[model samples]
Target: MVAQLRIYTINRGMMASWLQLFYEHIRPLHERLGMPVQNAWVNAERTEFIWVRSFNDREEIEAKEAAYFASPERTALGDQPTRHIAKIEVRVMEEVPATAGVS
Candidate 1:
């Protein structure tokens, strides 16, 4: 299994709108496309949105992401958040089973 961590930096004064758009639109689209989100969080100042999604493998992740971004729904609603986002960072990670039970 693998996880994708995405961090989105919102433009000044646009955090609330961006979050709304993400949860109302983007997140559901992703979930329907097979990329189930594990968790979501905001930074202390609320300027950044961070989320994690799990996949069976890297290929699954790539395929789901490709389909999601290329879909008609995405084409229509995808840009809604772009204007509000200053930057985005994505990281693919593998869990360390050895530490699974360790706090």
Candidate 2:
């Protein structure tokens, strides 16, 4: 499986508002699109919001994300969600396949 580690740098003093939007709207929308958020975290300083999403493969990520960004539901959210984001960093990772002789 492939996993994407998403880290968002929330605007200063907007962590609470961003988290509200994420839980109430962003995460729910992703779930409806078959892109479940595996887990999430916030730095102690509250400047960074981190989350992970797993997919069957890289192509699945591309397809689902394309639909996600193009969804009318996402459009309806307008700038409410994005306004709090100051920066975004994404890292794609894949699980190491087991070898036949390896335990």
Candidate 3:
């Protein structure tokens, strides 16, 4: 299995509003992505927020993410905040030991 992490450094001024909008609109798509979300984070000083997106395998992650991103609904949600996202990063890692609980 492969585990992925998505870190989003968001603009401080818009955190609360963006978080609410994200939960309201993006949460469902993230869930429907059929991927595990390890957790979402907010910095101690409320400077940035990080989101962890986990996947079971590379094939599943690569194949599914495009469709998720291509959807019209997803596009709209992504367009919500223009200046909110300061920086976005993704990390993909293969587990040292295999865990095949993917169904």
Candidate with top lDDT is: 2
The true-versus-predicted C-alpha distance at residue 84 of model 3, in Å, is 1.4
Question: Which stretches of model 3 miss by more than 4 angstroms?
Answer: 44-46, 98-103
lDDT (Cα, tens digit) per residue for candidate 2, span 69-99: 9999899999988899989999999988788
Predicted structure with the largest TM-score when compared to the true one:
2
Score candidate 3 by lDDT.
0.75
* lDDT of model 3, residue 52: 71
What is the TM-score of each predicted model, taking all chains together?
0.87, 0.90, 0.77
lDDT of 3 at 84: 77
Please state every model's RMSD to the true fold in angstroms: 2.7, 1.9, 4.8
Candidate 1 weakest lDDT stretch, 10 residues: 77-86
Where is model 2 poorest over a 10-residue stretch in terms of lDDT? 94-103
lDDT of 3 by residue, 1-103 (tens): 6777666778768889878977776767778878666678888484677777767778898777887788788787666755678787788888774556755
